[model samples]
Target: MNITYDWNKGVWSNLPLGVKVSKLHKFNALPVQFSGSYEYNFANAAVVPEWSVNLTVKLLFPM
Candidate 1:
């Protein structure tokens, strides 16, 4: 399992995106992740919240 925190105090602050944070876990060797973030449109003065879930599988073979 893994978790992360990201903060951008310069470039990203002026864009339509905000802080990006996510968490990842391994289930039976498959990777599953959940992410949530905030969006900001400075020009329009709007804020939006978003979240997502993703699952990934990996194939491995012995050499």
Candidate 2:
């Protein structure tokens, strides 16, 4: 997700787009992951906040 607006510092901004909810039901292999994120900020009447996280592990070549 991404939203933004800035008209002469009119204040508005946020971004949080993460996906990978346990990665259920793999088709070939490599099924395990997690994702996270958070962000926000404004101007003129400014406010600020931001955060992000990502975890992964994909090693599939054993059949």
Q: What is the alpha-carbon lDDT for the whole of candidate 2?
A: 0.45
The per-model lDDT (C-alpha) reads 0.43, 0.45
The segments of candidate 1 whose C-alpha lies over 4 angstroms from its true place after superposition are 1-14, 45-63
lDDT, candidate 1, 1-63, per-residue tens: 222222543232233445656676676766666666555444322222233233444343325
Model 2, residue 14: what's the lDDT?
A: 50
The sequence of per-residue lDDT tens digits that candidate 2 reaches over residues 1-63 is: 455565666756553444434443455665534344443332222333454444555544455
TM-score of 2: 0.24
Model 2 deviation from native, Cα RMSD in Å: 8.4
